[model samples]
Target: MTERYSRQERFTPIGPGGQAQLANKHVFIVGAGALGCANAEMLTRAGVGKITIIDRDYIEWSNLGRQQLYTENDAASLKTKASAAEQRLRAMNSEIKVQGIAQEFEAETAEALVDGADFLIDGTDNFQTRFVINDVAAKIKVPWVYGGCLKSYGIVLPIVPGTTPCLHCLIDHLPQEGSTCDTVGIIGPAVQMTAAYQSAECLKFLTGHSMTVEMVYADVWGREYSSINISGLLNPECPSCSRDAVFPYLKKEKGLKTAMLCGRNTVQVRPDQLSTLSLSDLSSHLENVTDRMKENAELLMFHVEDVRFVVFKDGRTLIHGTENVEEAKKLYQKYIGA
Candidate 1:
């Protein structure tokens, strides 16, 4: 180990052997928000050989306070989180390979993106996406660290397939609906604390240490912390991680057509069949119908009435100003056409 990782390598538990193991490991991270950014930076500096991060959202002014990899310029330009994070991670550790995928990690693309990863990390904020990650991890027999934060509280769990309880085991206890960062708000320390726990678990796993599967909960502001062994939560009958696992979440459904972004007052609309869209042609076509139109290589931004429209090359349109799927779908059909 060089001077770069000298300190980390000298930390008895992760000495030279662990450092060597980390150099050859590939970690796949989902989401590029607060947790994702923090986790990526830590792993990169720890000399992880390769890391792949996928995220669908773009950076915004509100993200700068906690999402570590983004800058004011990235937010101003509306750069996708994955691409922006990739650029920063590469700069941090040129010796390691970092690939940031700018797309949604749904059932359709989840398995493929996590193909060669040694393990997975959850940086995603929503449960829907986490379920997809859980499904992918269980199907491939890969371990994943789950972390979530809201307000001052956060939770972390490391799920190892066949050995420990998978996410599906705790589905009933997981938050179905509650406060969100946009609503109740979140503290930067909460995000950092959650990400720290998640990163520690990853380090322990990647460094050849036997992982202790546990669900950890903490409230940074309240200064409360607790953990419980979740091994008992493992259900042999779980369709997702059972011995006869069918991986129901990975089954081909028509694909999610519309998703109401939690706490953002935004609705994402995806056509039944995806197609490459020509932004230039679309820009010219919608010039009369839209206002404050902007175009870029990755996506097109415009406004229809009071709503903001962000259209990606893959024909996925994020309709801001409304969380109603029906309303967003109507706008999509009327403006973007069928």
Candidate 2:
């Protein structure tokens, strides 16, 4: 280690040994939005050996207010969040390895993305993805940090497979549907507070330090902070982490077929099974019905009236200008049937 990490290494808990351990650890992060950007940047600067982060969305003007590792130019260019994050991370630290994949994190691919990770981070905006992460973590016995923020409030929980209660145990308490950030609005401080707690937990876990089995809650604007012990929430009959675990979220039927992108008037539709779509061929086929059709190696973008469609290689289509799942599905079917 050089003088670069001297300040971090000087900290007693992490010292030289913990720093070394961190340098050899691999962290898998899902979602390259606000939380992911903070977590990945902190870990990258702290010299984490490797990082693999995935995101389905691209940068936007709205994201710039809270999301790091992205700029106005990135949004203008419609750079995928994953690609932008990877570029910034590599520029931050050349000593470590960083891989960014522009893809959706669903049941079919969750296991593979998290396979070799030493730790996992929840940077996703939705709970469906978190459930998948919880299932994969429980089944594989990997520890993960979960964090969420909305409207000046945030919550964090560090989950160790067997030791701590999994997310499913607290499902009843988690809001399934309510006013989201899109409706109520989110503040920057809340996002940072959540990410800070998450990063601290990660440092402790990766450095071989014991972690508390509790959920931390905070409202930065409200000036409130509290934590709850979730040890009692561990259900004996829990589907995710109980003795007879089923890993229900990993099943194809339970996977998300349609998701509304947070704060965006967009809906994403994924096929039941992934298919390799030839963008060139699809672009050619869509020329008759679509306008301003554009094709690249990875994706194709076009417009049908006011609705914008972005089709990916894995048979996933993002229907912008509307959040209606049925309408998005219809558009997908009409434009690119897989």
Candidate 3:
């Protein structure tokens, strides 16, 4: 395994120098689901010096089919995605620094999340979180790779801040939850294809190589592919990329506390006021409810009446098995004492 990166370095595009450049860089991946795990595995094997993975969700049996980094045990034990990915990546490449933070990505913590990072990679399933990543990346002038997979199709774009059109210019607004990705089921190939393209772009950008490719679109199962030149799509009136620096999505009013998840049939409710909730204490209290409960460093998860509750240290909740916002809220209040 010591010679793992040899073949990669031999590839002329990313020769020894580029490999060295990547060896000194730090990358921040915003999610640890399908795309996030794939990218992390690629970059780690490629010899990226440091990687920080931030994710809010935990592993489920369904995630094992495409997420790549987790085993059935990870899912059965209710392991946090970020932490699990970190453990897997480190096991694959111990020379690299792999740190995982089990936290939700939102406006309040977006800036700090990208701190000291050379590049950002978007693996988030929702546009709201993607927009927050874009806003934070744009504010810091950090280049970010945006990749999304839905059904058999996927989209990949490299946003270089002032160099290229941002995500806001391409998609003006995010779609409503449950109707977005849940309706159009994604395949494993689509997720891998998108993340491969995204990881390639990330390596190029990190090594100071030129990116000649514009937006990449692919329908792996359909055997369709296209390279779109989106230079004309730049919106000067765009709030996130208009140079005005007033990110509309980053604003407090622009965010919603509770919303339905795209494909998970879940609703996430985040408290506006931050709290110092202790997962350990919460674990002690929830132990009587169900023996299926699991506790990670910053997460406490359990099941009640066929409903799954994933509670965070910051007083956020991702309730699975139902998309009803009110119903999810009631469950959170009942189980989490929020």
| Model 3: number of backbone collisions | 0
Q: Tell me the tens digit of each residue's lDDT in model 1 across 1-338.
A: 28998898789999989999999999999999889999999999989999999998888887898899999999999999999999999999999999999998888878988999999999998887888898899999899999999999999999998779888877843465756776898889998899999999999999988777778999999999999987888998887888988877776667448877755789999876778999999999997885699888999999887999999998999999997889998998888876
**Candidate 2, lDDT over the whole model:** 0.89
Please tell me which model should have the higher TM-score, number 1 or number 3: 1
Better of 2 and 3 by TM-score: 2
lDDT (tens digit, per residue) of candidate 2 on 91-196: 9999999999998888877888888899999999998899989999998899999999999999999998877889988784346577888889998889998999
Q: Please say which candidate is ahead in lDDT: 1 or 3.
A: 1
For model 1, state the Cα shift of residue 61 in Å.
1.0
Q: Candidate order by TM-score, highest to lowest? A: 1, 2, 3
Candidate 3's residue-wise lDDT over 1-338, tens digit each?
55878898889988888888998999999999889989999999889999999988888898888999999999877788888898999899998899999888888888977889999999888888999988888889998999989989898998987668898888878865444567768889999999999998999888888664489899999999999888888778778977776987778753338867768989998777768898888888888888888777667778887988888788888888997888887887788765
lDDT of 3: 0.86
Error of 2 at 105 (Å): 1.4
Score every model by TM-score.
Answer: 0.97, 0.95, 0.90
Off by over 4 Å in 2: 172-175, 254-256
* Candidate 1 residue spans exceeding 4 A from truth: 172-175
